[model samples]
Target: MTIQIRQFPCRRDNFGVIVHDDAGGPCVSIDAPEEGPIVAVLQREGWHLTHILTTHHHNDHTQANAALKARFGLEIIGPVRERERIPGLDRAVSGGDRIDLSGLEVEVIDTPGHTAGGISYYMPDEKLLFANDALFSLGCGRLFEGDAATMWASLQRLRSLPDDTMLYCGHEYTATNARFAIDVDPGNLLLQERVKEVEALRIEGKATVPVSLGREKRTNPFLRADDPGLAEAIGMAGADPVAVFAALRERRNGY
Candidate 1:
């Protein structure tokens, strides 16, 4: 079965993605940020909506859940930990739960950092990861609800995915993230080259998403907090990985 992915930008910086199984299976939206764009994509693609896989309960992510569910009668699935917060949530799932979207299988990964109940959807067949706000191209999400240790552990789960996995995040903050990355890891050749590429993409008004997990692991400082080189660069050599992660997050808050 061929899975079609349609990704579009909506709201201030949020992304809306739709995953479809073209072999007469289910078509699921990642997060319902708005009704209009999702409806537009459905109309353009001629695909029927079957479900909505929500990553978190943030308003920007779940605001349109009720409207879409009302229109299409979709099965809305979200994090069990925040089921009460998600609008129109039908099924509450946790990390180990596997969802069967027709013949396709979706792995639910708990990633509680940006929010206490944040989760990410990983499709092994497609090598697609709907990370939402947990992970980004050149950075990671801010600690809004969870603490440093929690967020750090959450990132490790994502980091364990295959290197070739394609990541789709919640926002278009790659440009800013690239700048911050360069400032923190000035001597990192991979990051330096990546910053140039990110600049060029932004210069032409293109989205810098769908970044590979391998590239992110090599450059994203938050994901690399345990690396001895990064630890020393930030004056935290030999520090615990969690401590290093905390310091990195603290600096990012100011950046």
Candidate 2:
């Protein structure tokens, strides 16, 4: 039951992840942003790559899938609807489909706001979520295909996960996200504290992600879209959850 995570740098400050079951032998690469870092980490850790899990069709997330597959012969798992978008599709899965990796069960969630066929991986046993491009620490993904309502529903699905779930989003955008969170919720003491803490981490050249769901609920403006205070901060009426979420996301897009 040993679960490990390795982070790699990718396109224009994005991130790629490696999730491994120490006893399962091969690991799952969350998104193939680049090949060099993935190769280096796999060689260093001696972890076999069993699968490549894609969240969407964005090139930043799927560009290296073919190369990785050619090199390792690993399975590529992506949204069933995105068969044409993603390269080397060994398995096409949809929402609620469960895949077994050795002994661990991974649940696929169809979160389609970021992309038409975006999907997220949730490992309840490890309390880990590979929430690529959809939800960040304090921000949500831009509306590329889906509308605000769809994004809201997608985020609400993520909010229903256990509070302790560790969220691993697809980019190193937490510092900027925290700043935006503060702007949207200046009255949130938790966000205030987190801004300072995250700033310090950035000063030290560290990552501020793998942020807990509990913390996101308490401090993240995107996740707190149901709060009245946040709605007002964005010049909206009380507790319009969808409105608040949409406003926050739009602001972050501009931020």
Candidate 3:
């Protein structure tokens, strides 16, 4: 089954993703930051809203959840740990819990770092990962609730996905993240080149999202925190994965 993904930018840099099945049986909205865009996309495609999958309980991610659920009678699914925080959570899930949407089976992946109960939706058949604040293209999310160790481990889970997996993160922070990446890895030719590409995309008012896992592996410092070069840049002597990850995240938070 073919999967269709539509990313809508909302409130500052937040991204709301809309995912649909091939035959259009069930469409799931990921992180409803606003009602208008999500509704417009559903209406435009004539897709039935079956589920609202929330990665975290942040207002920018779940503010429109209640409105959308009421308007479309959509079932809300979120991490069980944050059920009280996210509105309309009909189904509370943790890592490894599977939910079927039409013929698509979405596997839950607990990624608690940006928030206490953040989780990503992985569609193995479509090789799509809705990795909200847990993972971004050029950087990882800030440690709002969980610590660096948790965020580092959370990112490791995303890094373990297939190289060609399509990563649908929860924000449009690629360009700014790329800038920070360049700072972290100045000698990284791939990141230097990507910074230019990202700048061009931003200049043209285009979104730099849904970046491939392979692409991110090659340029994103957060994903390459285990690389020897990356470890050295952070003043560490060896390929100490956690140190690299911590340094990159700390630098990004200040960036």
TM-score to native of every candidate shown: 0.98, 0.96, 0.96
Name every residue pair that clashes in candidate 3: none
Better of 1 and 2 by TM-score: 1
Residue runs of model 2 more than 4 Å from their true location after superposition:
none
Candidate 3 residue lDDT tens string, 1-255: 777888878878888788887675678898889988888888988887888999999898998998988888989999999999988889999998999876779999999988988999999988899998889889888888988788888888888999999998888989889888887789988788889999999999998988789889889988887888778877785856876787778878788
Which lDDT value does model 2 have at 126?
88
The best candidate in terms of TM-score: 1
Please give the CA lDDT of all the candidate structures: 0.93, 0.86, 0.86
Mark the regions of model 1 whose C-alpha exceeds 4 Å error after superposition. Answer: none
TM-score of candidate 2 versus the correct structure, residues matched by position: 0.96
lDDT string for model 1 (134-220, tens) is 999888899999999999999999999999999999999999988888888899999999999999988998889898999999999
Between candidates 1 and 3, the one scoring higher on lDDT is 1
Q: State the weakest 10-residue window (summed lDDT) of model 2.
A: 237-246
Per candidate, the number of residue pairs that clash is 0, 0, 0
Model 2 per-residue lDDT tens digits across residues 114-150: 8988999999988998897888887789899998889
- The TM-score that candidate 1 achieves is 0.98
